[model samples]
Target: MTGQKPVTIVAIGTLDTKLVEYLYLRSQILEADPSINVILIDAGRAAIQHEAITVSQPEVLKASSASDGSLESLPRGEVVATMIDGAKRVIGDLVNEGKVHGVIALGGSGGTSIAAATMRELPLTLPKLIVSTVASGDTSSYVAESDITMMYSVVDIAGLNDVLRAVITNAAVAIAGMARGYAVRCATPTGSEVRKKCVAVTMFGVTTPAVTVARQRLEEMGFEVYVFHATGAGGRSMERLLREGRLDGVLDLTTTELADELVGGVMSANEERLTIAAKTGVPQIVSVGALDMVNFGPKDTVPEKFRDRKFFEHNPSVTLMRTTSNECRELGKRIASRLRANCVDASAIEVWLPLKGISAIAVQGQAFYDNEADGALFDAIKAGLDGSGIAVKEVDADINDPKWAESIARRLVELVNSKSKG
Candidate 1:
């Protein structure tokens, strides 16, 4: 501990409204480990003058090209937005410069929004924790694809009481410990480490067998496989990693999130789901695994318009609606268009269509089986990539067939090798 670098923890909040609370939080952090360095960032609208405030409100406004006058003249939403932008820039610079090991913030909705926005920009390796009044409900918007930890504040962050103190003290201690570990990890050398070539694979409950066999085969071929669940957040996370150049290849076996996006389902990953790998020139083998179903919350939650659609109750809380032939065709066109439009080199991409079935429930007598829909999807993809250099192959077996999964894995290995050679 004597020779180790000091762990620096950043405490961010609106000082104008919550100066006392921030002071207490900082005190608790330093009390836990006096050697830990704490930097308090004031994101308040008003410029608060205090030596303890490492980054002032004025500095934040300047980072976002705003002034103190803008706070009064601008709408509350715009003011918060400007402050968030400023705080993000300030925090981003600190993280880049290795001045921040961990970040923690306490706030209501407004404070949480500012802090969450700033913290989300930082690296996932850095510890980010937020104690917020709205943490008990759905926090997908706040934590989206980031590893930011959210803690529920039992009471509002108005003023510190016994409950608030206990919560703040616990949060402080947790962050301090995390910061110490993070600092140690940062100091550790990693340049000499030998890591296997990593591949990102997408999966769904309906396509688990295919992904499982493929993942195993990939591992056997000496590639490290990261399997993402194909949920909205999971797909987004995988795409982010791909853009960051963390993945060497992709085996996109479960493109279900695309179905969710196309059908206005709850788990949509947006329109950018399949474009990152193409833009990055990462060799990818795409398939229509689980494209047969659009995810919904429950049987009752299925929209009134889709009441007549084929439905599979995955569980009491999870429902799957079969994609119509028209929807399948559109999804195919979207996937092919994204790949073709974004790919720097079409040779790096391959589309594999399973002829017999795409998902577990789509084979033979299962609930979602529909040859017409699957055919529409395949035809659209082929048509969309008609002149493109990308290769489109059809496998006679169902997606989960062991040999088919193995072939996909082996082809990805070839693609990766071919890219390296090129």
Candidate 2:
């Protein structure tokens, strides 16, 4: 089930246009490891004749359940969508049938889009790489919430040339190494090697003190604590793990990403930050740990409307803009809605508020201290959950105070134990 299985690397591209380049890539992979098995998936829709076709366009269309003529007759968007669907189905079957160990795809904009979509359907631990002509730009679309690795094809992925050969050769070797390594390291553990009870905690620079203390205490109580930075990607990763059943409980302390998501900041985690734990019915302790500020990159990056607002220069490259009372209220209401939808078992959820301050710069005499904003957030949450039966507690201590951190750790332990009993 592990390395005992031979590594099979699936190479996907438009063999119609790049048959010579595809052959060169295959040669490089064989040069790296002669035993490595390679499968060619032709995802092109054009009716170009090519002799080196392994998995033909007709096969892709059949797997995707699209009419053979749709690729040529349909609009370009529809054509690409159908091809992507076909690629996903084919890749899924290959993995389930033990024919695919890793996936490597190379192409331009259209090819990259199709390849990335296919790679995203694979498991998180699978070795998925995309060598693309558009890798250096905004890759959020290509790697939305997946573990697909992308490499910039310095030169275009055109026909074989001296420069193209070097890029494709390097990519081939990299994928080969990735496939071999994944096969060995990704086996499920057993016996005493099994993991301890896991807990997910959120962290940001402003809330590090509290999170660090809570994490240490949780580990002391025989639990494995994973602290995800409150960046967009970090929150997404945490949610992904929760959905995968990797954690037993959650300590969603640093919810500052909500502010960014609501107010158009750079580090927003969308609206799904606290939804997964609630949906899974996992025991959770939520807090407004760092909701006082929205994250932005550089002082100049702040929008014109926010330029006059209270701003803290977090570092040379980062700026923290204080959220307004209206924004806090909106955030609180949004959070409550998520909790109501997902946390159906009210007894399993607890919302804690730090009365003194929410983050490092929000305490009295600090840069982000805004009593009106803080009060609005607190009142909004209380009103939103007036009859929801979820417990809301207020602490007079600052969020980073050792006493507050200790209390949070203890409460989470209690909730985890109670859920385990149920």
Q: Give the best candidate by lDDT.
A: 1
- CA lDDT of 159 in candidate 1? 91
Worst 10 residues of 1 by lDDT: 65-74
Which segments of model 2 are wrong by more than 4 Å? 1-3, 47-54, 65-69, 187-189
Q: Give the Å shift of residue 223 in candidate 2.
A: 2.6
* CA lDDT, candidate 1, residue 143: 94
Question: Which ranges of candidate 1 are over 4 A from the true structure?
Answer: 66-69
TM-scores of all candidate predictions against the true structure: 0.97, 0.93
For residues 59-119, write the lDDT of model 2, one tens digit per residue. Answer: 8878896556456669888888888989889889998886777899889999998999999
